[model samples]
Target: MGQEFQGGVGQVAEGDINNYGININLPDKPEFRGLVTAQRKELHELRAKCEELGDDPRDVWRRVHAQLGVCSISEITAEQFHEARTVISGRLEQLQEEADKRRLMGKILRSTAEKDARQEMLNFCDLSFGRTQLSHLKRNELQRVLEFVQQVEINPQPAAEIPQVQTAEPLQLREFLLMYKTNAAGLFLFGIFVGRFWS
Candidate 1:
């Protein structure tokens, strides 16, 4: 069975804490918990290795940073992604075979991780975070899918750059006087032409 707590996912039982003395910050965001938990477990395993290898604490952290720098696989077409998944599974299995007999735990983590990744991909494809996996996502949905794909990042506009007053320019005295004179001349000509008729 998968890890469970009385409160919910990521909630450590009081007993679990007493027995294991594990007090790491459990991510509260339910959606992100799986990925965060997997990363934490990997860190713990690496730390254990450092303890075994007599590596310096700073060196261990630096090594972890370097490993984290390894970029995620590029987002690919559905067909290409399926092919990559086949290759990735084969590679993971090979790696797992070399490690201790932790096959079952690895399977659980892998399954959880794949679920999360697929959900994320689906969100992008549907242009919706609230969408489910079984929902239709096809050629017509490409634009929606791209919204969450992170193919490129957008920089937000700075508030300081926004003009406080839209009419920022001062009215020129010369322009105002010219307009007034033009209006006055038109009124004067109108008075001369129409005043005689009224009289």
Candidate 2:
């Protein structure tokens, strides 16, 4: 028999009148830990997906919009979440493998600082910018180039002869921005602090 109360409807609580409307086991979920871990994993997976897409996956996930909605487990079924996770994870793995191959190709560019990496970086810049013919790129790609050059330790120099390549570690974003003001598109991508629509 179903419990009833002052509420004139089905499945109401004894003292208060909150209708469950559905059967929930009320399992030992360890709510905060379980939900938080799931949320973190989902977010991490989404970050990987965004990298594979070469653009923000938040737009695709409708995650920002959904956050506004405050969707519940009931609102978004677990199956949907599972499907999304699978697709994103698969793409992330594929992209990571391809990136490793590209990294190998990148190694050749690194071995000759002044000789090769500059031409390769310039070629990437051109291919990357394509029809726009613009030196500037989306801030993310600009950072990517800066990171690549730094990793390769490609230096600009007026040398008497082809200088020996020396691999310097990647520079911090601030240092790159300061050093390559002319080359860098001048912005940090993928970040926020104190969300607001500023005037």
Candidate 3:
């Protein structure tokens, strides 16, 4: 009823569907499974932290890989997991602090600078940093823009300077008077000549 195969030691029995030759679907060792589960949990936590910080999860993973000297998170040993989490948490905290500082700088700019001054600052940011939004600027760039706005606020240029057209006005008036005198003199001479001819 069953097929037998010759082995190095003796004949091996090939069981039916009810009983197999070898159980190939055996579960993994507890320690290995536990390590994998722990790694997954750490990865999930890192991703969640990144989401809360508004950062890219890929960047966090890259940092972890670099620090752990691993190609992927699964390659990170149980011993290295704590270090990886620490790196990710520290980076997220730093990012949060930078974001808070940027917000404060933006608030100061808005409160102290006028609309035009703010606009000028934005233009400066665009030209210097290639970023127009205050949120996108780095800390030093934000500081420079804030300084510019303060300067503009302190020493504002005049709204407008009306150029002097007075010189051209006098020349135009003189031309008009000379033309009127010439026309009046010619008319007076013609009337005198006509009156003498009639007499």
Candidate 4:
């Protein structure tokens, strides 16, 4: 008699099964199963990291394939999968470290500069972290901040040299009128000189 195939949801074999004409051979050894499971988990984690880093999943997978010297993920062996996992995990850790560094720089920027200045800095650096909200920046934005920080480190600027932001209230009516009159007088003299020249 032929080997009996169980008929239940959980009784399905470990590998892909197609009722048509395709056949996929799954490893029977427990260790091989474990390795495949680990490889899939690591691939999932790397995909998640790619999303967090705002990178294309296909591109990241291609890079992983290149790093492991494999043509495709499907062809990756247990050892190669382990190496890929290590490389991906290291990249994730590096992104986390960069995010931490960006947070520190944001704190410094907030402490030393005003909201407008911080916003300007973010704009110049092509970052998306808001002036009032710098708690959790995306990886790319954090990288932008990291680059800005490195530039600042290379050409150090004194803290005292940073421009101060004026958050004072609007001027009073009398103060506004006085200032307007002073500016008007200068403009009047300049206009007279120009008019005389034209005449």
Question: How many pairs of residues collide in each model?
Answer: 2, 0, 0, 0
Ranking by TM-score: 3, 4, 2, 1
lDDT of 1 by residue, 1-199 (tens): 3534444344534433432656567555543212344444544465555445444545554443344442232222333333433443343444444342343334433543544454555445355544444233332343344433334333445666655767657658777567698876887899999999999
TM-score top scorer: 3
Off by over 4 Å in 4: 1-35, 114-199
User: What TM-score does model 2 achieve against the real structure?
Assistant: 0.28
List TM-scores for all candidates, in order.
0.18, 0.28, 0.40, 0.38
lDDT of candidates 1 onward, in order = 0.45, 0.54, 0.71, 0.64
Error of 3 at 57 (Å): 1.2
lDDT of 3 by residue, 57-130 (tens): 88888888898788987677777767877888888778877877677686647755554566666677789999
Which has the greatest lDDT?
A: 3
RMSD (Cα, Å) of candidate 4? 19.5
What would the TM-score be for candidate 1 when compared with the true structure? 0.18
For candidate 2, the lDDT comes to 0.54
- Pairs of residues at least 3 apart in sequence or in different chains that clash in candidate 3: none
In TM-score terms, candidate 3 sits at 0.40
Candidate 4 residue 70 Cα shift, in angstroms, is 1.3
Per-residue lDDT over 22-130 for candidate 4, one digit per residue giving the tens place of the 0 to 100 score: 4556656554322487668768877798669655677767777888787777767776767878767766677667766666766657543533345445565553455
TM-score between candidate 4 and the true structure:
0.38
